[model samples]
Target: MAGEHEHRDVSGGWLRAAVFGATDGLVTNSSLIAGVGGGGGAHHTIVLTGMAGLVAGAFSMATGEYISVTTQNEAIHAEVANEKAALAQDPVGEIAELADTYIARGVSPATAKAFATELAASPKDALHVHVQEELGVDAQKLPGAWTAAISSFLSFSLGALLPLLPYLLGLSSLPVALAVSAIALMAAGALAALLTGRSPIQSGLRQLLLGALAVGATYLIGHLLGAHV
Candidate 1:
């Protein structure tokens, strides 16, 4: 057992939603804060803007994730129903198809036929195999729309809260806000890379750079527009 290891369950849809929502929240709120501060907005205005962005972005991410996951699950369910009908109407042809599939995967023709025939004796087993081979998803493991939605909402709120903390605490310093957000962004990227088995340093730096770019661009635009206005 020393050398044996199990792989992480990366197939769950919640992780994706959480990571995307968090990163979007960090980037979006940070940029909004930078823009408002650069435009010479008062402390109260910046705080209000950050709070609004956090609430709106979290809800948006949750709704989008729920709808997307639900639609995909429905599509998979429809395909499964179709496969079930085919199994009932033409059992023999379905058995032959399963055998052919095994054969294509290098099982001998005789063994494949024998195995497929034996498997067909159980309707549930036959349906499961056919669905996996044809549709490429586990009928028993469909993603939960509520799970993804909740994860997105919570993660986005947490991420968006980081940058606004300084202002909310009455620091009223954009530099302090950006510094805190920068650290959080890099830490988040590193954590994601660690989970997915990638280079944490590379991912962290990439996140930091991209966030800085967005903040910088927004700040510059706000500054220019404020000057003119």
Candidate 2:
């Protein structure tokens, strides 16, 4: 009997949705808070706006992930079913097809022949291997809707809470609010890096700089527009 090997996949629906949702929530909500505050909105009004943005953004992310993952899963299943049917209807032709594919990819004829022979013995496993290794598709991991929904909702909620820090703490100035927003974004990036196994320093610095630039630009614009008015 052949020993089974554990498969390790780096990409999936949950990872994609969680990462994107968190990043978007952090950046978008932070910018929204800063821009609104810079435009001279009251603290309570800013908090309400941020809360609305958070809820709307989370639902939007979840819905979008659901649609995308569902479409991809259907396509992968359809392809696998078609391949299975083809293999069942014509074993010899399927073997030739597999061999030709390997040969086109620079495998030697002898090696391709051996591979084709062994694969023909277990056509379903062979098909799965081809789909995974050759085509980079994972039919088994077709994004659970609940997982995507929860991750997106929670990520956005967590990220959106950052902008509310200054108001919640009763800090009474635009500068203080902006500072809190910057710190929140930086912390979010650090956490993201820790989860994703990247360099915390790099990620934190990137978010910090981006948030600062956004606040500065918006502050300037708001000041100019206020003066003109």
Candidate 3:
């Protein structure tokens, strides 16, 4: 547990979705704005495109996260219910299974059986123990679908605003917008790495590079389209 310090997580749960939504918003909106500007789009058209990307991206992220988390959570809850049923119908078999689990984890056979017996004396305790051992899920920490959806919506919109704010303020310089976006992405990446015990400087640079690539690629494509299409 030396490296297992508590910090914000953003890999495979609500936190992941929220962080993904925000970082994606920043990179995507910045690229869209850069692409439009590169294509010689008028000021109004550029701003409009950035606005469209922000709104569309936020809603899309929120909707996708909602469906994904809800479906997964429903499946897990169904499993928990089935576990409850099994515990109710076959108390002895369930206790044997629980004891087997503990024994497999290095507990002595007699001690494991005793532990299982004590747990089975209370229905709620047995249910909790069985569910965790069988499913590797913590009932108390199950993620909320609604929370993920709302968090994604808000975080994404806020991130997208970082790149779009300059244009809205009548700043026509694309370089300035890009600079702001790069710095924002670096900071976001560094902050995200804090929880995972990664080097913040490396993470920041990686994010900056990726965001730059996205902008560069879109800008070139937009320029080609404007020139030839």
Candidate 1: list runs displaced more than 4 Å.
1-4
Task: Show pairs that collide, candidate 3.
Answer: none
TM-score of 3: 0.90
Q: After superposing candidate 2 on the true structure, give the runs of residues whose Cα lies further than 4 Å from its correct spot.
A: 1-9, 104-106, 191-198, 217-221, 224-229
Ranking by TM-score: 1, 3, 2
Which prediction has more favorable TM-score, 1 or 2? 1
Give lDDT tens digits, candidate 1, residues 42-121. 99999999999999999999999899999999999999999999999999999999999999999999999999999999
Local distance difference test, candidate 3: 0.87
Candidate order, lDDT descending: 1, 3, 2
Best by TM-score: 1
Q: Stretches of candidate 3 above 4 Å error?
A: 1-15
Would you estimate the TM-scores of all the predictions?
Answer: 0.92, 0.81, 0.90
Of the candidates numbered 1 and 3, which has the greater TM-score value?
1
Best by lDDT: 1
Per-model CA lDDT versus the true structure: 0.92, 0.74, 0.87
On residues 1-229, what C-alpha lDDT tens digit does candidate 2 reach at each position? Answer: 5897754335665655676577677677777776777677787878887788888888887787777767777888888888778778887887777788889999998899789879878866877866775457777656777787778778777766666667777764667766666777777678667456678888888878886777677667766665666
What local lDDT score does residue 46 receive in model 2, on the 0 to 100 scale? 80
